[model samples]
Target: MQETQDPVITSVKPKSRFPKSVPYIIGNEAAERFSFYGMRSVLTLFLVNQFFNPTDNPALTDQANAHANKLHHLFVMVAYALPFVGGMIADWFTGKYKLILYVSIIYCIGHVMLATFDGGLSGFELGLLVVAIGAGGIKSCVSANVGDQFDATNQDLLSKVYGWFYFSINAGSMISTVAIPWTYEHFGPKWAFGIPGILMALATIIFFSGRKKYVKVPPQGVNRNNLVFITWYALTHGSQRKKGEAFLDVAKQNFDPERVEGVKAVYRVMMVFFFALAFWAVWDQCLSEWTLYAEKMDRVVNVGFAKFTIYPGQLSTFNTIFLLMFIPLFNYVIYPWFDKRGIKTTPLRRLGTGLVLTALSFVIIGVIHTSLDHGGSPSIWWQVLAFLVLSAAEVLVSITGLEYAYTHSPKSMKSTMTGIWFLVVSFGNLITAVVNGLIEGGGWWATALKGANYEWFFVGFILVFVVIFFIVSPRMKERNYITDPVIDGEVAANTNSL
Candidate 1:
């Protein structure tokens, strides 16, 4: 039997300061998020109010809610699904740096397309296609690039760095989510869409500023075939002929140790992703289902300066606003405080807590829905409470997820596994799309949920899976992966699951 050893990561000297590239990357992310969420804040409203007029077709008017929601989810589903192709290209062909640069330009063009042909269905569809391609293509690389900035010596700082990363994202998101809605209402759709395009241009420029400062991982080249060959060789060699052998045990017995280790890492990542997949279903609702619910409520605010009425969609900003506050609190005070007490707040534990909080947010939503159904106009303050809970859930699941995917992924497949992580989110949206299709088709679910209305959406059902995954998550093998120097002529990935 061959006994090839896996390369062990060597500890390097930790830099006294964070990488010079980090601020630039964080700046780029903030601006890019502003561009992305700014457009997203008003998309459904544009489609419903302008793209298709209710006066022309009564059926379109009646089903406008479902149609707009479905379209929004479909856009998200396609955007996330495209990352698999993007991840493969980044990992095996063009490296992440170049791929991100190229795709981001396309993203800017998409914003221009949306701005130019405001409210046209055909143009909207085309723009969404191009934007999805560009956004999904770059998403995998960007997240992994954050981790590439650190190595074994300072890997402990990754979680905190990701928190700040997410903080930047929400900083941009909070602003755009609030400002864009007002822009759409006052200035117009063209201006609103154009603003995001301008931000995208700035984002590209900011990213390029970090070019020399970043540690760029070169393309590893394609070796998916090696995986297939190893699997075949193991099965044929009778390596599984032992008591209590599990599936893939033959590969472990016959393949190199590095290959077996890579396989194990991949397996652990898969387990975490399943739970993450469920978490996304609830988290993403802040954009889709929750917005629809918001439109039904009253929106009056007194900032002590003046009394102002706002759009319901603008309420989405609350999630980001709270994130801006909470991320720091947890990173500096809360998490550190717990560490002093020897309470281990591992990623898995945080994930489980996030799940429980997510379910609680839905319960709050359900209560609000009941009031709305009974013709009691609940104040917007009630939503603040819900957003606090939900945003806490997000801090746990989404932010931790970014760090988790990069750290847990096999060295060779960093970008590829990150892409797969996004695909899990895609699957969540697909599930929502399917269920909505059934409800739209006027099936038994539609009849059953008629009175329940918006409250009938799957909070408890998703929570059930979250609990199941949480129970299984402690069993997930946790490991710390740092940026390692490439070994000559050795494949970065050792697993057979390319």
Candidate 2:
């Protein structure tokens, strides 16, 4: 990796230069990733056979791909939805760390139930919901907590920390996705899932152990105040305002003049959050529908030492593997080269590229599906390439977005904004559910799969979103909120504390 000076890098220190907090966060993230990917990697396969409708027939399976797709879509949809609720819970009652710890326990419970009992449709669905609730709570809090470790004083290291943080997530995911699926395939479902449950338990324990080492930023009610101020500002500045503005009459009592700039700043961040809905709608499919598609492909690998069998759901591991490899290369080498040439590598640029790359990934899958439709047996390398491309895009968008959103939002509203980001994924999964339903109906599914047009359907769907996001990108603010300090009677020196 090159050491060329980038404005982004100069503005934020190398995460390597930071204190011990980096290791703590990385450790927590690794364990969390192991728990998440271990379960998620096998969710589609488990739902179709082990949990929902236990089966043994090979050629014509008891539960078809369509049913698995629908179940996968709904599971992902709820997982994304619960984050909003979890974020709110963190804000109003429990703090972020507390919420993460508590929900993770519930998450472990869900895995235990899946591993131990006869989880039929209702039982399995309940387990998925529990997992979602736990995941949502943790997802809402954890990334921002990583940011909490650094302030403006040491914020120069933020990009590096974020890079390393993402690396840890992939490391954990790669192991679980590959190993857990293999275990399930051969050793049986109990060991596959039970192992993840143990990992989750360990993660929760690790988090509690490091409670004192973490940054304890509580959720402040900044949004509620911002809304009141906006209402007042609208009423006072209106050309059609009466002698006594009715909206301002109600709003003025709650508005504090001392926090006016802070209120405006929070609103500005909200502006960017509104645009990400479409990006996530397309991004979430990698887990939900894509997994099922990969499952259908033939993935028998014959190595010298042993014969390796690949599961469709386990293909997600490739994304994580590539993510681990690419983040450092891009952050240290690729972005720096671009930066030397005066190209902007800010969060917005990364995010825009992510949108495009996601579209491209679907395009690749669509092409494969098209060839396979003509009775072609596509090589596994195609899927591998797709994961590689998608991982590059993941680094550009997903990891950067996590770092960006956490740093940019009002300190008090961090969890809420994280929840919003997850909500965008929820919306995406919901859209996927609708799309899946459409494909299942009106002769479309048969035509696409039989004619190898499934690739076209997937490609066409993503292209539609790619165009939508392109139009939306310009409206997004390129300048970061992290650079702008919200003054609220605290000394400027304390800005980093936020």
Task: List TM-scores for all candidates, in order.
Answer: 0.80, 0.76
Which residue pairs come into collision in candidate 1? none
List the lowest-lDDT window of 10 residues for candidate 1. 489-498
**Strongest candidate by TM-score:** 1
Candidate models: Cα lDDT each: 0.76, 0.67
> Which digits, one per residue and each the tens of the lDDT, describe model 1 over residues 1-498?
999999998987656557778998899899999988888888877777776543545455425655666677777888899888776788789988999999999999998999988857899778977777877878877877898899776677788788789778878988898889899889999998999999989999999989999989998897642344455655686644567854455665556656655655665677777887777765666787666667667778898989988676688888777877888787788878988998867777777888888888888888887887688888877877899998898888888887777777666556556667788888888777666666666758666655345454667676777768756665555555564433552324322110
* CA displacement after TM-score superposition, residue 112 of candidate 2 (Å): 1.4
List, residue by residue over 1-498, the lDDT tens digit for candidate 2: 979775663465444457555676688789878977787777767766764346645433322545566667677778778877766666657777888878888988987776775345677677767767677667767876787787767777888887788778878888888888788888777788788888888888877878877777786653555444456665666665457744343343445533443344445555555445545665656765566556666677777889876777678878767876897799899989989998868666676677677768877887776666466667667888888887888787677776776676556455555666676677767766666555555365544544335545655666665576567656654324467554465212211100
Error of 1 at 163 (Å): 6.5
